[model samples]
Target: MADLSDATLDELREALAAELPAQAAFDGWKPAAVDAAADALGVDRDVARLAFPGGAVDMIDAWFAQVDREMEARLPAEQLSNLKIRDRITRLLETRLDILAPDREALRRALAILAMPQNAPRAVKLGWRSADLMWRMAGDTATDFNHYTKRVTLSLVYSSTIMAFLDDESDDFADTRAFLARRIDNVMQFEKVKAKWRGAGGERPSLTRFIGRLRYPAI
Candidate 1:
C-alpha cells in the first residue's frame, strides 16, 4: 500500500471503487471486505489501507464523496437555474436519494457501521460533507459564518431525513420527502425569526428563548 508513495489520491480511490462493489456485497464496509476488495482490484491488498487509512470509516466517506460527484453530474446546471433555493435543495437531495435507491440495503449497513460510538466523529464529518455538497450544488455563495451555520443546520436536516428514509415505505419515498419538507420548513421559520430579531434590536432574550425552543422540535 505505502509502497507506491507516489500514487495519487485519485488513483487509490479508483482502485477502491473498483473493488468496493464486490466487498460491499458481503459485509458492507468492514475491513475484511475492504481488504478483499483491494485485493480484487489487482493491487497490493495493503493498498486498501493506503486508500483509506481510517479503514471502513474512510471507505464510507469515499462512498459519500462518490455519491456527491455522481449527484452533481446528474443534476445539470440548466435543470436548477430557475428553481427557488428551497426547491433546488429539495431537488438535489431527492436526486441523491434516487441515486442511492438501488443501494438501499448497502446504505442501511453503512449507517449501522457509522452508528457505532467510536465512529461518531467520522459520522459528523460525513454529514458535514454531504450538507456542504448539497448547499454548493444548490448555488450557495455564503462565505462568512453563515457558511458554517448553513452546513450545520442542513446537516441536521439531512441526517433526520435519511434516518426516516431508511425505513420509508411510501411510494417513491414520499414519506421521506414529506419529512424533509417539514424539516426545511421548520428551519425556514427559524431563520425568519432570527432575521426579524436581528433587524429589530439584536439580542432579545425573548427571541433567544423562542429560538432555543425551535431546535429539533417535533414536526
Candidate 2:
C-alpha cells in the first residue's frame, strides 16, 4: 500500500508478491493476474512485467518468498527456542499451511505449473530453500552431511504434506496435520537410530549393546 512509484524492480516484486496470489487464484497465474495485482498496488503494468521476467514461475517464487517471510515473522526465534526440535518443525510447517490457507486455489495452480517438466528443477530448488530456512529457524547449525540430509528429508516431508493439504477437507486440516506429524516422527526416529549407530565418540557399538540401547535407551 505504501508509495512504490519510485521503488526499484526488486522492491516492486517484493511488494507485489503478496498481492499476486489472490489475483492468481481467480486468474490462474497468467499475465492478467500480474496486471490485476499491479493495478491493485498502483504499480505500473510495464514495470511489474519487468519485475517478473520469468513469468508464472517468477510470480510463484516471489509469492512463496513472501510466505517464508511471513512464517518467520509468525514464529520468530524466541517462539521456537523453548520447543523441542520435533515441535519446532511441526509448528513451522503448520504456520506455513495457515499462511497459505486463504490462497489454496492459487497454490494448487502454482504446484501444477511447478510439476511441469520445464519447471521441475526450479520447483526442487524452491522446496529445498524452504526446508533449509525452516531448519535454520529451528536453530539447527549442522555443517556436516547432516546439513544436506536434514534438508532433503524435510523437503520430502513438506512436499508430501502439501499434497495432503491440497485435498484435505477435514475441519482445521486435521488430516494434513496428522500426516505431517507422522512424517516428522519417521524422520526423528531415523535420526535417533543413526545417532545410536554412531555411538559415543563415533566408535562402533557392539551389536548386543546397540540392540539393548534401542530396547532401553538412557533417559
Largest TM-score belongs to which candidate? 2
Candidate 1: regions farther than 4 A off: 1-9, 18-22, 35-46, 204-219
lDDT of model 1 at position 182: 85
Worst 10 residues of 1 by lDDT: 204-213
Model 1, span 88-171: residue lDDT tens = 988888888887777777788888888999998889989888899889888899897568767877877777778888899999
Error of 2 at 211 (Å): 24
lDDT for each residue of candidate 2 in 123-216, tens digit (9 for 90 to 100): 9999999999999999999997678778877887788788889999999999899888877876787678669765655644344443343333
Model 2 local distance difference test score: 0.88
Q: Can you give the TM-score per candidate against the true fold? A: 0.81, 0.90
lDDT of 1 at 60: 74
Best by lDDT: 2
